[model samples]
Target: MKIDDVVKDTLGRWAEEATVPQGLADRALRRRRRSRVRAFAVMAGATATVVATALTVPALVQPSGGEAGVILAEGKPADDPAISLTGPPEVSADPDATPPTKLVATEKTAMYAYYTWDNEKISDTRQILKQTWYLYNPDSATYEKTPWAAVDVAAGGHVAVLEEAQARRVGLLGPEGQVRWIDLEQPASQLKWSPDGRKLLLVSYAANPNEQGVFDEDGSSREIVPVTRTGFSVVDVAAGQAFFRPLPAGGDAWGRSVDLHWSDDGTLIWDWDTGSESSPPPRRFYDLEGRPHAAPPDPADTGQEAGLSPTGRFSAIHSPDRSAIAAVRDTSSGAITPLKPVAGHWIEQAIAWSGDDHLITWACELKGSAGCEVSEFRNRLLLVSVDGRQAVPLTGFRQNSQKPGSWEPLFARR
Candidate 1:
């Protein structure tokens, strides 16, 4: 009789009539359980005045001109400095050289941009000089050079998205070394592969590039821009169909970074707001047809940007002490268990989950007495376990003191 009951009845009928996949149903049940817990927590503390005020106002925060103020929403220390370090070891061997260290996980391979002071130049830029692609072979304990310029690699090493030198086209490299080219109308800034490896999301830029300016003592300033694209494209690899969607002007003006990701089921796309300091930006979702969809309710305000594993079973979180420590959080129970801390180093970013038990993360050493600046600090790829075991070094030495720091390491299951 009630509206909520009517909606539940409609959903029940739909579930009974439709042939739903078991995996999808299982995931839905888990989400519903989590949502109910979150709802109960909200209802316990919510008041009429708070609810009325929230409905009447927009929750957007404007960014200041210079460096954004550190809000520390996750209980991290306000004075926490950026990690810094020395350059990596110079390449003395062949052109396709690998790191000196070896990884314990021999089943996975890593793809990264190898930087050296010497090499042929395709285009002379501040960052791209003498940069090439290399594949780390765990079995041989060596690095193999690949011809294609890989931007991102998919899971299982089945597909890769690449960009050719001055070609103005994007290529999708398949398993057999075959290439399928997708012509772009504008230059692309970022490429991300879906968790299922079936779709690739490409973000492109136009006139007003996404950049920030840093001023020197003399008042002269230089701009540091990463990705300048304002539009996005979702490519279906199997069907070879690419659809371009242009973002509304000023849609992403508030954030310092733009993050795009595919939903777990691969049926929707999420554009997360990384700029808000007070709370996690309410995520915006889009259906496969590019239509805007209502976002699902949150269970609780975790107050941290917790990185969820590919399976959504656990979250990679930082310890409250803000030391060089990492932990695993069980999503269902919200219990935090500390992973064995990598001595003298802190987790910078949790890149991906290698499997059920292992996580691939970037870590930097503890700050020196002189303090560590981000420009001088280097990060190394580490393979760590959930049970707090010793962390394994996967990549070469620390990132070389290049202009743009180090290349982000990409992991593929072998």
Candidate 2:
């Protein structure tokens, strides 16, 4: 049987054999009632992606605990700058009288989640997350921000996917600030736009097995929620249609940490390995239909697979000495080209390519008074030319006590 057929069969068997305890069933019904009321209230004025009558699926499985953390892989290039010798340019010393209200609206700017403390507590879990954009200001020689909330943006900056976190709804934001909401059966967490900006990868989590009782009671223990890969949905923005396919099996039990990458052609979604070894994990690819495809031939075991360029010709590599420098390795020939390294800083990871000659990467300053340690640093977005000549800073170094550094950036070329 085909993979899709196998998936359908498995889901059918699960649906038939799954049983809910009486207490759990009662709780689920009550929760559903509450959700329905909230859904109706929220959808009254907004454009919903799905109709009220459409069947809703339960919470899909996420990596672990319904939260995914960013993973940075470390390795020297199996094969593998110069603009500033004094170190990265410092930001303006003078404090602004008031924080800027609007970001510099430009196609070259990239949007990211900027989290700030809403309270005096130092915990990030209590912080408020605002969508923010980073734009370079040539006059001031600094990067500025404009706070905007968006789940993902297309390559051209003409369209954006917005998520209503509270309502569990997805919406498309046009260049003119227009929105068309999409209603999903299950709550989704990660929203990744394809390289071409034509498709989106939406991931949802499974139901939490360890839900607490309505009233707190002594010895009231919740079940341990296993880490499982629920499934993914492919949304075609132009067509305004989303297709969800469940995994054939219960899903991988690899916990909640996963790095998802899209093939340059946008035909396959690659789930990279998160283990600590230098060897690449077994390759896995999922097609648009959510069916598994045969593993592609191993390109090279360069340990830079996660940072492959859009053309698949090169992979971003870091210096073995952790000097805050980066280079590119030709996948086939294993030839390495060292790019310009920012003074007093190191490149975190190669995010995306701007054409074939320039790469977007995260650069971090070495922190600590005694000496520089990779663990102690602050990061900002940068655009670096492959020839070790031009290094443009895109954002100010972001550091917080709660996080190792600012949230990772999502990049696209205009």
Using all chains and alpha carbons, the TM-scores for the candidates as numbered come to 0.57, 0.55
TM-score of candidate 1 relative to the true fold: 0.57
* Weakest ten-residue segment in model 1 by summed lDDT: 37-46
lDDT of model number 1? 0.44
Residues 163-278, candidate 1, lDDT per residue (tens digit)? 43232344444222234455554555456666676777766555323234443457575335354336667766655556678753233443223445566566776665444453
lDDT scores of the candidates, listed in order: 0.44, 0.42
**Candidate maximizing lDDT:** 1
Best by TM-score: 1
